[model samples]
Target: MELIARATAVVGGTIAFLRRMGSPAHQAFGATPDIPAARKQGIMTLKMPAAEGWKDGRLPVCAPGLKVNAFASGLDHPRWIEVLPNGDVLVAESKEQAGPPKTLMDHAAQATMRRVKAIGTSANRVTLWRDADGDGTAEIREVFVENQNQPFGMALVGNRFYLGNTDGIRVFDYVPGATALAGSGEPLVAFKPHGHWTRSLIVSPDGSKIYAGVGSLSNIGDQGMEAEEGRAAIWELDVATHEARIFASGLRNAVGMAWEPVTQKLWTVVNERDGLGDETPPDYLTSVVDGGFYGWPYCYWGKTVDDRVPQDAAMVAKAITPDFALGGHTASLGLCWMPDGTLPGFGAGMVIGQHGSWNRSKLSGYKLIFVPFENGMPRGPARDILSGFLSEDEKLAYGRPVGVTLGPDRKSLLMADDVGDIIWRVTGAS
Candidate 1:
């Protein structure tokens, strides 16, 4: 404990050390995490590193037996990546639109994001990248879709291509190998898109249903529940009828979604609500359940009541606990399944891109990680796939990874770094 205290003092000056003086981030990990008592600091701990992007061929430090390089760069805040059936990569480039901060905390939050260049007029476009030569770099770049409203999620199903703007999902006529859509898309479903604006999309294995994650309008319903209607839940849409229904509720900010190969279960990484100190309520990775309520506003971590919100006993009683904790404020956003043998020296598991944390004193995640799985369950501790995204002093972050997907080559991994505006490709070292 003395040595840890000594280490925290040098981590990120004084504020960081004070925040981290409670406990190391990793202790609040795994299925059964060490969740300390909740104490409302009412203070947002911002420990963002100065955004110093990659320069002069610098790259994120890869784990042993792995190498990393830019597959595509010079993007406009690419937030999500989707690999098409034809192996074409589509990037959803966007940023938060500036709005008046309602509180002093909100004001400071906005200032921090503005300094990091995280908020601006969004590009509102999807760009396509083609690595025709398979040399791991995109030689062809094209604007596939434009005039979007904070687009994030995308999917290609049969002849229909689905793209998610903050407000709704649009479907377009698409053909395999086609470079771009000919015209506008038809609206499939409308969502109340405001606070947590990102709408992540994924298709079920049978292709009969599509799932979209919609987040709450305010943290802990601070803006009132009336403003949070039809949000903080995963909406499942029927492909044939365009009908949508809530699949699961109380997922604060569920982003990444993927199917585990062995069990074929849907899984997601959720960014939990903050302000309850750093370690109490943790962001998590969990399997989604149909008609399940995981608790939000009123409860957290399976019936653990949050006194900040109006108490709802029935809601708390029904709140389901998540499967695994990914550390508080790590902002685990991007997730994808990596099959065994796809990358050398790794087994079948999930690859997660933790976009790092701003509300924590000590940074939690700004790198790619792999969680090993056995029989469709996480079997062991997470291993670092990529790291060194920040300076040694933890005061300078070069990049923050968001969306992740398997590359077309089947042997490489592609990740979108929103801060760096680059698509990084990782492959086993020769």
Candidate 2:
């Protein structure tokens, strides 16, 4: 037993030493940020912080003029949230059910997940929180929908409520004041199984179409491009005909998507590839063009080719450079636009929920950031809105922010903290 303990300690010390030495030099943030040359490796770096639950009387720190409070607590793995028009908040309690490990990489990933308490039986349900008395806290909590298959994105158009499950999009008839819903919904579109599972949905400005962001299966088409069909792109689904087509392509993992209020253009926060050192191939926020390709396996950040994949000259020529960079491997997700005139000092901007990094030598994200917009483009660097999710030493995490949305009142921001199982409310301080 003593020998085993010593061996484990040695291994842990070696890993820590490598991580400190391998930390990237450049900081990955801001619009038009620098992309340092990649330090490529055959086998990727494995660095993940240990997950630690928050202690009693502990809470995150908000920005100077903002205050933070828990709006709801004790949720079962809340991953995404949507505020209904009638002032009710719907939260998806979806967790990943990672089965037995198949390959060596799968074993390593699963081990990391187990250490972080990430693998578990999924709740597979959506809960509704209603604050009928305007108390800023939910007085009524009920199961809005149940028995879902890893549901993530949600949208409501007219009287139809759309739920994007891992395999398909389900549509249901929504009544304004109902507390709960049951019965099997009709499947609108089917998706083949893939690696990047989260499906973010949004209704177009005219409400005539729905856009769904489907992520790629492998890190860089490692399993071959044949397995990545209908993946790694945004799909435009016609509302009336239920017809769907690829709207954009080659986005490694476009998770969080929203419609810019000014330009009426679709913007997305993408998660770039891993294995390269921390600074190359920064994840981006860009205005997605219809039928456009952003270069996944063949290239990155427009024209820089990833030599790992076979060169495709034709596709490389057509790759479009993204509008903004949100840092490399930061896993930036969860996009929500600040409603016009909601807050006085804060101008037209968008809040991004960066879920933090697992592969970097040092952690990058784990907070909510605001990117100011001017004429439909990111104007400056991202400002941290709510932070302090990681320990002071950056070795432990209390929570990871996943989804951000405007509250029912439209005056504050609501963020879903999956690790803490709490809905953090942030608003301007009095």
Candidate 3:
């Protein structure tokens, strides 16, 4: 028994040391990160901090001149949010259902993922929260759409409401002020299942087209590019004809997308490939070009070739560099622009919900960051709007921010905290 205990301690110590001894130092939060050498690992590394619910009267730390509070609570895995014209806030309450593992390592990874509460039985619904009186707390909360297929993103175009599910995009007729959607909408497009599952939806400025971000089937195409057909790219759908095609390719996981108000160019926050070490590749925010490839399995950050994939000169040449780097393994997911530039110190910029990372030794992200923009492009360093998600020792996670959007009044920011099961509202301190 003593021998077993000692062996366990040795193994844990070794892993801790390995996690700490990586080659590339963490990059600072900004546009141009100095990406260092890769420090690849042989096996999958697991370093998820256990989830600890927020205590009563405990709250996240807000930036100077800002205040944070629970807009709503007791949610089940709320992943994404959309604010309606009538000030209704809709949350996609969902989770990923782990499929049958194909390999022993796959099974082990899935087990570890479950242990971290990364995947679970999805609630499969969207809930509506109404703070009718403009108060901080939501007074009316009810299920808006039930029995969804792990819904993530939502967009209301005219009376037609679109919901991006794990396997398809569903549409329904929406009536303003309506609280519930009982009808099962038809699928606009059925996507290949079980890879990177979060589908972010956005409607064109003119409302003539819809874009859905479908992630890769495997990290760096381990499942082959065939399985990645119509994926690892943003899909453009015509609202009139229902026709769809790949808009951009090779974005590993473009989870959050928005249109820069000034340039009117489409932009996204992509989660770059893993296993490239602690900091060789940085997750980025970039403008999306039609028919352009950003380099996924084959390469990254424009010309940096990923040796794990087959080297193709043509593919690497066509790969365009991202506009800005959020940081290595930051898992930058949510993006929402403040068109009016009303939020003080956050002028003409966007707010991103960095879901945090579990791959690195010292954790990165797990907070809300605001990137100021000028002439439709990121211009300055990222500012932390809210933090304190991780405990002091960094051994436990109090919450992880996911989707972020402007509040009903456009004076506050609403963010979804999946682990904490709370919707946090951030406003200027009075």
Candidate 4:
């Protein structure tokens, strides 16, 4: 065992050294010499193909094309968006500074929630925008909630709005005229604190359970997976009993989760383990099977062992490899399976938000992708749906799409650009 450990350590060290020396891992994933030269020659102007009917700075109309209108813009880091039944779009704007001081002895503790001198203010709040007037634009903008601590995912169920934050899940009464979230609602569930602190929440289709995507605090669970509560798993909580248990584990960072339309099966987009010189473990979008274990610290993408840790015997026995593997370091985010009989060609297709990458030397994934499906399974290659988020040179990206949803009209698509603070509506060609 010690020999195996030493050998793994040596391999890891060697990989790290090679990475520092500028290996192929530093280049864009699947980028060939011919591809870059062709791009330079204006062969492929952008990484992904432009959406159909998107010309003249006006979106094209679709088969059952609905009018595409902007609800809100000029938001600061708008993370998640939930559209209410009355056509009001609620946007969660996270701008949090470091919290108050924890102790005078350890005054230099620099954490967002920990007690540290506030370097600056964070905009942890929620905003609402509605097209009150028939102006085809969002004219009414109001602050719905304020003083939140890095809230991300939100789900609206009837008259209540469920919010998932770093601390726990909080419920707010959706008063039509309530300007702010000052009127306290009931606390649903308070999760045991763990790392990878972003806890994304979603309500089950039947509303019996609340599914929370809890990410591991560190890469490969170096913090000792046993010690961490709710890390690296999809946790399901009984909405009535408030009882929470692990639905699935070893998922590293399953940041995005949604339900398929026809199958009603739960699906997730995971940001897979990093390091390993970049290309070793590809991020994945897969259907989450209950009680399944996706090899995280032990293994990855099936058979590709992550050299960072010695294989745990028990975990190895329970590990179930991911169904589909996305490209390496793509930073897969919010996903929505297209409903059946919706768009003309996008029936039952999967739309995933690629939040772009920062770890790799060269950039990748700054647009939306469509993974077509047939008989409730992924069909062929995942095609780029909405391009132009990034430039051809790969130097800079204007917007990072985080959340995607079909508008109420079912024909138009609404994309939440977190960086650009804009919700873009793509209509069919005119």
Candidate 5:
């Protein structure tokens, strides 16, 4: 049995080595990347970091002049966060439900994820934490909301709270200073569940509208485009009337959305298609325009057509390019605006939580990264805000960060590390 397994691994490695022809990973950065020809999708190139918990009072290494501490721990896969005006922090705890594998590929993918402790039983609830004494620790913990459907994104608008579940958005009438949700939630909008199941929600700056991000149901429409209706786009719904419109389309997996403080333009981080090579079509951060069409099934990075999918030349022509490339298969998920002086040694920018890669040959993006913005546009390559999530050999992950948001105090940073089951708080190192 051991010999057979060894032979299988060797065969897989040889296949990957022979099929490797993508552009350099670094070449995939910046506004204009050198996208090379798409490589053949081999048996799947995977390098997953073992999800290990931090031991012996250890913590993630932050950039200079910043410090991090576990604001709350022992969570059941805390993947998203929202801080209330009263300084209460809400952590959404959930995990993917892959279900029984259907084929050899499915079984292998499931096994890889399971070995890394990625897939597990979903907690299906949101936990709230309160730091009453401003001591950088949460002395209070409670289940703020319960009976959610694989919740991910969270937002509290005025007296109402919104939760992004796998199938739709739920809104509840919230009471001030309340640690737990007092009322039952009602459906705000419905979505086709499965595939990329996590939906992210964010309120408009004026609080007049709510935007929900729905990702693709398949890697690149392998499940037929009709099955992808109402997915892979950001939907804007009126806060009062509940009227919704497809604000932007063709986003493969738009996860995180933010308003560029300087420009006030909508921005998002999208997970691009896989099997196209390590860096041929990189995931991106871009300003989403009203009715904007970003290439998903047809093209990427400014209409560079992906030849794999059945082409529609007209649809491909309408594809608008993304603003910046954020490394291929990085799975950049968490995004939040950080103003000038918000964090030490960092200017105004967007802070992203890269959930790390599962399909790339070499590991990428297992850290909290910051992309500096000058006048609301990405200025340069991303800088590490908090790193060392991976072990020295890069085969183990102490944590995988997801949602990022401003702390309840409005002066600190809060990040969720799902694998480590911890909600980390970041503040200046005074």
Candidate 6:
């Protein structure tokens, strides 16, 4: 019976793929469409040769050339990271307090998102840091925004700063040389808030469209799809027109997204469905296509249907499987493509911040991974570029990386840790 079931699924997936071939959904889920073949090929040629100095363990102190620097300190629960024009870094501190420890039985039956609270503690705040004197250290740190209700993602376009929170989208004018929110501008798009309140924002490469990531409210089909207003999808809103629509759907939780420099394609790191044991479904990093469905409540990965829910055969037929799986429940977030001519070994590579996990019996993730790209596409496997955030014994972890971005220098990497409430900078060793 098992063999027959597997065979049926394969046959169904193949047929579905064939039927949807050349369709708009197919084109969106397909590989880099606009990139030139020659440049893409060149991007694939770059090799990440191992360096003798780049070891696996944590450094004694934050130092340059070690690819690790503590840029800011004393944060409550920093969740998202964004770099500004003057080289200042903005961090969103979720401020949600950790609940009491749970037993194995509680974890087995509890909902992952239920126990977690979106409301922040009194420490909830946004901070901005700038390194004065070019000493490679942030000497100035100021609180920019306060009393915010669970701010997650932030984007800066032209003179305005767009913020995505649990409530709705808010905008403020960028006050140059102003560190505090005293002179900050007013709010912009105040729409009806939806599920998975942590919405990440990004602008199109040309800055015409503003995209926001909305995660699913429930673990599976618990929050009925049709009943929920705006959940489990990416929404694209025109900056000039303020027009909004569902850009893509069926993604469990697309926490992070960024446009590729060479290919101009949007890629996302997803937090897949949970509660199906330890390894039932795997988190993924893939290209986001317009109107694409990525197997959420009904199906997963590509063809694996969720037996728990009433399967939608028509929707599953159009859902695209992810390009690459980043193992189960790694909590992948904040994906960015390393531009060409920026770093030597990581040209056109994808850097993902694994926020770690609380579901599995044994803890996993809690590090930064480099997914190499060949010809403007992800290569075979992802390699761990930064580890040691969690102890080997699994007893304790210092940080939970939520967001990652390239530094203003364009040669370094910056990661935001919500658990430790700090920002780490990574650069190549001299």
Tens-digit lDDT string for candidate 4 (1-430) = 2343344334434443444355343322221211111001111111211112123464312223334445567776676777777777777776334434444311222321121111234467778877677444677888888777677778766667778776778888776545556565567776654356556777899888888887876666665766555778888878778787899988888877888766888989888765553444667888888899988878766545555577777777677766666665677886876765655455567888887754443446776777787877777767766766665654345667777776656665667776566777655544
Candidate 3 residue-wise lDDT, 234-309, digit = tens:
9998988889899999899999999897889999999998876666588999999999999987888888888988
Reference-based TM-score, model 2: 0.95
Q: Tell me the tens digit of each residue's lDDT in model 1 across 169-229.
A: 9999997888888788899899887688999999999999999989888889988888888
Which lDDT values do the candidates have, in the order given? 0.86, 0.83, 0.85, 0.64, 0.84, 0.66
lDDT of 1 at 390: 85
* Backbone clash count, each prediction separately: 0, 0, 0, 14, 0, 5
TM-score of each: 0.95, 0.95, 0.95, 0.77, 0.95, 0.79
lDDT of 6 by residue, 175-251 (tens): 77678666444555543354455788898988888888888766776747665457788888888877788899888
Give the runs in model 2 whose Cα sits over 4 Å from its true position: 1-16
Candidate 4 residue 343 Cα shift, in angstroms, is 3.8
The alpha-carbon lDDT assigned to residue 384 of candidate 5 equals 89
TM-score of 5: 0.95
* Displacement of the residue 23 alpha carbon in candidate 5, Å: 6.9
Q: List the residue pairs that clash in candidate 6.
A: 40-375, 44-374, 44-375, 67-426, 67-427
Residue 281 alpha-carbon offset, candidate 2, angstroms = 1.3
Residue 241, candidate 1: how far off, in angstroms? 0.7
Question: In model 6, what is the error at residue 351, expressed in angstroms?
Answer: 0.4
Minimal lDDT window, size 10, model 2:
1-10
